[model samples]
Target: MNKYLWRRIKYFILCIAGLLLALLIWGVIEPYYLDREAVVAEIPLLSPSWQGKKIAVVSDFQIGMWMANTRTVAQSIDRIVAERPAAALIAGDFVYKPGDNLTPELDRVIQLVRPLVVAQIPTYAVLGNHDYGAKAVTEASASDIQRADRIQQALEASGIQVLKNEAIVLPNADRTAENDRLYLVGIGAYLPKQSQPQQAIAQVPSSAARFVLMHNPGSFAELPPGTAPIAVAGHTHGGQIRIPFLPEWSWMSFVEERSSWSWISQIRGDIVRVSGWIPGYGNADNRLYINRGIGFSNLPIRFNCRPELTVFTLQAKT
Candidate 1:
């Protein structure tokens, strides 16, 4: 071959090699790199005392997935403790699917989250479909409900409060407060037809300060207006293997099979919100923040989307 032709062939070969290396890093190495994201959310209904306090959000710790990111989960929990947030909210999917032998998997999950309880950070959680032993919303069954209860028991025993269609009024940062408490309304898993947003907030007064937590972002629509000044959720896992700016081409786009469940279609676009805040995502009066949780779904790989631990600093709107 001529010198010019040889150089052109070499250039083509180099380009292919570069592309392979990039894919390797994206799929293999990126899954382990935890991104500690700091976000600021303004809750107009928030009490002055609640302002400036930080709340850490994380989810989708599919602990039993093939080659799960357990190290990343532990590190992320440690980071939350170090930040000393007012509270830590775990969105759900504490386990992928532990099958009939659930004890060892549950034990690992407890070990990972024990620090938040030990540090007295007032951690709270809600269950996702995976935690209920169902891979899809339509797959939920009575057996799955029993499985979910076992997981809830493990989490509560670890001192991490798990809410299922329940609401808790958080005490102010200082112990002296008697009123103006911030309400934390946690909706249950969308599976097994367990999530009940209306009932979760029925006890919360109309003018009270509050936020909503659930595993599926689709549940945001069920919440009444003004009830969720801010809502947090995890389930998409930021599409697990996003294609960066071209999020429409994320892995979820290709992998999501057609389903009768309305929410299944929206997940392809949810990857766009990846690791930060989205204002007025559901109801114009409400805001939603989606966290790119720390684990895998069906595949143990992450591309541009790194595991995330979101630290949200609360500010009262004027």
Candidate 2:
């Protein structure tokens, strides 16, 4: 081959090699790597009594999925147990797709998370889109719904309080004041049928310091202001396959959010209305934080963003 042709051939070879190496990192290594993030925030309405309280959050365990790492799940839970946060919140997607191995998979995930139960932390959880077992974001069959119900029961049996369009008022550990309280409002997932932020918020007293929990960040728009000064969710997985700083590059988002190229904006706009209002393009009040969650769905690869387990410390916004 001539020198020019030889160089072109060499460049082509290098490009192929680079692609393989990247695949190795994204598909193999990154999925298992635990990215611990401090979800620190000072919300405007946080009560003085609940100051300096910490809450641990995990999402998208999605066990039984093709690339769902059970080992990583243990590490994340162990770390949270060690931290001994005042409370722990699991944002759903505990089991990926309950195929024939649903029974075995549920057992596996329950064991993996039992440590949290034994640790005695006030834990809470919500159902995710996948948990519904629907066909591409639509409601699943009765059997699928039954499967989800069983999983919810199993989780509750493990001592994790699964919240569904409900509010639970947990007393402040400090106990300095008789009336000190922290409200936890857990809403249903937005994808299938059970998303009702309105119902959950209606039960919470506006003056109470509350934090809303849900699996999908898209539900943030449905939440009214003052309900949750800071809402926590994880279904977006922070755009699981983010491309450096350009969100548009993350085409994988479309697949997960149930949209086609034709009406991507409308779908996402409906799903993530909050992303448009915040200063950085998120919730209207900038009170929502979408956890870059752990586990993968459909695809095993993750680039730029690693699996996450977040610890949030909240103080009154004074």
lDDT of 2 by residue, 1-318 (tens): 799999999999999999979766765777778888886766666667677888988988888887577878899999999998888899998888876458888898899989988888888999887777753555657877777788899998888889999999875667565347778899986777677889988997766667888887667666665456688887666556665656455635667545312123433332332121122333345467777778886777777667788888887776
Tell me which residue pairs clash in candidate 1.
none
**Local distance difference test scores for all models:** 0.81, 0.75
For candidate 1, what is the lDDT?
0.81
TM-score of each: 0.90, 0.88
Question: What are the RMSD figures for all models against the true structure?
Answer: 2.7, 3.5
Judge candidate 2 against the unseen true structure and give its global Cα lDDT, from 0 to 1.
0.75
Which residue runs does candidate 2 get wrong by more than 4 Å? Answer: 257-286
Which is the leading candidate under TM-score? Answer: 1
lDDT of 1 by residue, 1-318 (tens): 999999999999999999989898669888888998888878776776788998899999999888999999999999999999888999999999858788988999999999999999999999998887665556467788888899999999889999999999875657455456888899988754778888998978777777788987778778777678788888878777776577545675456443313453443344445345654356557778889899987789888889999988889876
Error of 2 at 303 (Å): 1.4
